[model samples]
Target: MNKEALKKKLFTEIYDTHWLKLYLHLLKMLDDEDDAKDVVQEVFASLWNNFDAISIHTSFTSYLYSSVRNRAINYLAHKKVVISYEKAEELRDVNFSNAPDIFLIEKELAFQINSEIDNLPPKMAAIFKKSRLENKSYREIAEELDIAENTVKKQISRALHLLRQKFIHIKYYLFFL
Candidate 1:
């Protein structure tokens, strides 16, 4: 089969084999059927779009599972932020003061955190996400990635250091203005 044919075949095989399991796993994580279905659909859609460039460090199943898990985490985190902002807006019903400040703080914090994560070296960023975003212990991350626990620790430490510098600069910049 050619590259195009292989990509199409692989996507079909994987989607058929994994879709239900992925959906169930996401349902367990998200506790809502619609959200679970949406996340699973997104995982497959991403796989389809990036099929040519996709790389799997481990088994394809592991990669698929991790992708769904990460997507669910991001969705829940965003949902939490939305809830917080909505609550803040409700508070604005009583007082309009500082509404923009609240929004600015929310937007700034999320942007800084996401940008810093994206800016990290790939290995460091992956380790950091496994640790912080997935809430995996150092040992767990190490085992999952087949690396030393100390390496995991060091990568996470480096990530934290870089993020701290970025945040400190942001704080000073905002404070001055």
Candidate 2:
């Protein structure tokens, strides 16, 4: 069989063998059906993408379970950030008259960042916008733009580097969350 065929067979077999167990494990841990499904799907997608280079120091079962666990942890971390941001917004509303300097700085920094994004080279700006704003994957963007995936990755990296240089002061606040 050809490389693509072999890869597909491997993925299909592995997915069929472990998908249900992973989904059930995640569902029990997350206690939300949709979130569990999303995490499982993301883990399988990552496995497919990285199959060629994945070195299983342990068994494949162990690898997949570990991936699912890590993804779930990351999902929970992101939810925490969202919750914290929402709480901060609520506090800001309660103390509107005494708003902190940091909030004002954040607002200004957001405007500056948008302006810098607009100033990026056209192709780079387009790729960055699709990836960041539209949440399109690099593969999707490359397919849509008829460019190589590596080119899309490079453009985004360059755009981020330029923006980081321009907004180094607010990097922590903007990038992490």
Top-scoring candidate (lDDT) = 2
For model 2, which pairs clash?
Answer: none
Minimal lDDT window, size 10, model 2: 168-177
**Candidate 1 TM-score versus the reference:** 0.52
- Model 1, residue 3: C-alpha shift (Å): 2.9
Q: How does each model score on lDDT?
A: 0.89, 0.91
lDDT of 2 by residue, 29-143 (tens): 9999999999999999988888888888998799889999999999999999999999999876766655456577668877988899999999999999999999999999999
Give the 10-residue window scoring lowest on summed lDDT in candidate 1: 91-100
Model 1 CA deviation exceeding 4 Å by range: 96-177
Candidate 1 lDDT over 1-177, as tens digits, reads 788998898789999999999999888889999999999999999999988788888999999999999999999999999999999988766444635476777787898798889989999999999888999999999999999999999999989988997788777865544
Q: On a 0 to 100 scale, what is the lDDT of residue 71 in model 1?
A: 95
> Residue 157, candidate 1: how far off, in angstroms?
34
lDDT of 2 at 146: 100
